[model samples]
Target: MQPTVQPFFESVTGTVTYVVFRSGHPECAVIDPVLNYDPKAGRTSTTDAHRVVEFVRQHGLQVQWILETHAHADHLSAAQYLRHELGGAVAIGQHIRTVQSVFKTLFNLERGFRVDGSQFDHLFREGEKFSIGALAAKALYVPGHTPADTAYQIGDAVFVGDTLFMPDVGTARCDFPGGNARALYDSIRKLLALPGDTRLFMCHDYPPDGRKPEWETTVLAQREHNIHVHDGITEAQFVRMRETRDATLAMPVLMLPSIQVNIRAGEFPPVEENGQSYLKIPLNAL
Candidate 1:
């Protein structure tokens, strides 16, 4: 079986959302979709989501699912918006309940907010197999970047979310809630163990100045050559480097607002009692 994937690069987030289909089939799945929001303007637009919809319509691909690798901290998900426009069920990891539990306290959400993960249609489990067209994927529960992170391995390609980045960027940080440097070390090893030629599609990448965006690479290349945490990099060394780098890093530009929306399958917070939607910010809270 063969798969066809279209990667939509969001320049704002440096995240790649893929629309993938089976050879000779019109059914498809969308991974990591983004909703276009401008904080400066406080308005939401569907430019990004519409692009994927038009592509699906142009190709006559029936979207069956909208999947999120985890609750993202960097961008608002377009999953709900796309579901409204395109018709599909949205899914996330079973451990999203953990994320919901933690963030609810952080944001002081009402007790009515369900932290049990009923928000999504499917709470996928590790090693569970699902299909997108003719391509079958096994959920690899790789959780170090986030407790709920799951990499979907379909045929020769692995949608590795933020667990691993493009080889040049090394991997995702293990400092977030439920994230662990040592755990990330073990999780990546599982991915690298795939066949040498397996394609690893990363969730995000911040290309160096003047360089073009690079978001896809091979597992063998990462196993042999990823500069930060490749085969030879020890767990101790990686943890140390990761800690040092995270110390200097400011939280993601969109962290506070994004997580609150994303954990609910990309739905915005309640329209405030003031009759407006507001994103809460706890100053110095990261």
Candidate 2:
């Protein structure tokens, strides 16, 4: 069955959150919704997520799930927030535990944070199949961008989080914790192995100046012309190229604050003795 997609653009975050519903059923799934967070002010808002909720309500859609392609390190997820409002479970790749384990030590977080990935409602394994509204989705463990990265294949659209970027912009950085250029090459190869007609829906896009951000493309197009990870590129060549490009890249603008919050399913760290939750910033730690 074909799916209907509603793309929600978060301007400041430059991320595309999609509301995907099976064509004949009113049941819907929300993918990678963003919770607006202002790190400078240490404040969080429900505006973006609420917009999605309002849309769901208006459409009389039964919220089936809040799907996260991976544990993000750039923006806060609205999964829990929407889960609370809509009574849907939050799900992510089972490998998210790898991310949780890595970041727990990196941030020197407290003992309370569980690395088993029990924090989310469900953790999907590679090749796992599930359904939303009559449409079936299979999880493809697409690591290398991050340890837990996944590509969700639903109907003709594949929700690829940070695995590939718009052609002109190239792909995501393999410099984040657990990211590997060599592994990324393998992941891209796996993605290209899909039906060439598969639609690729990326998690985020930072468009070049004078252009609007785009979140969707075709695997055929990527295979033929994705500048960085296209099909004819050798794995060693990809690693060399990816690393060189990453070296010149600055960290995600929201890296420090985003990771601390993201690993916790977008919830801010618990408020301390002073009654204010705190996020850690490691000096010269990248």
Candidate 3:
């Protein structure tokens, strides 16, 4: 059975949050939900998440899982917030341990911080299968945007998080810590190998030429027209292009604060004696 997908775009961060479920079923899953953050003011609000919660309530959907494609840098995750309000297990790729390990040091997290990926309710293995109501979903490891990116394949649809963007946008950058252009090329190949008509959902969309945003496309379109890694694009060619482009790009605006909270499954650092949680920015550290 095909799943019903409703996308909620948070334009401020260029992030798209999806609510997916089998038709006629009350159980569902949310993928890549966003938590609103204002960097200038250093505050977080759940307006975006509340929209998701309201949608679920209106549709009589029971959230079964809150899934992350990866620990995102552009926007804060509402996984923990959604779980607390909607009652779903928060999950991510098992390789999140690799990310947690890297950032734990870079961020100089407290000694009590753990890198074992215990923060998430479930750590999905490559090809691991789980159920969203009656719909069977498989986890596909698609790292390189980050070491922990995983796409969820449910029926004919795949929720690709920052892997391949709309044909015009090309693909995700591979310059973040642990990101590799070659690995991303391989991962995109695996995604393109899906059936030609398979529907691919995106986690973000940055439109160009003043066009409106889009977050869904098909495998056939990607293999045929994706400017960065279409059918004839070789790995070496992709790596060179991706690396060069990444080098010219600036880090995501929310990278610093997002990573600190996201690695802890969206929980802020423990409140100090001052009774407030703070995010740290390490100087000269990427």
| Candidate whose TM-score is highest | 3
Q: lDDT values of the candidates?
A: 0.86, 0.86, 0.94
lDDT tens per residue, model 2, 227-250: 897777898888999999898988
Error of 3 at 60 (Å): 0.4
Off by over 4 Å in 3: none
The local lDDT score (0 to 100) that residue 177 gets in candidate 2 is 82
As for TM-score, the candidate ahead, 2 or 3, is: 3
Each model's TM-score?
Answer: 0.96, 0.96, 0.99
lDDT of 1 by residue, 179-278 (tens): 8878888889889999888888888988877879987889899988787888888889988988787777777878887898998888887786889877
- Give the per-residue lDDT digits (tens) of candidate 3, residues 166-192: 999999999999999999999999999
TM-score of 3: 0.99
RMSD of each predicted structure:
1.3, 1.3, 0.7
Higher-ranked by TM-score: 1 or 3:
3
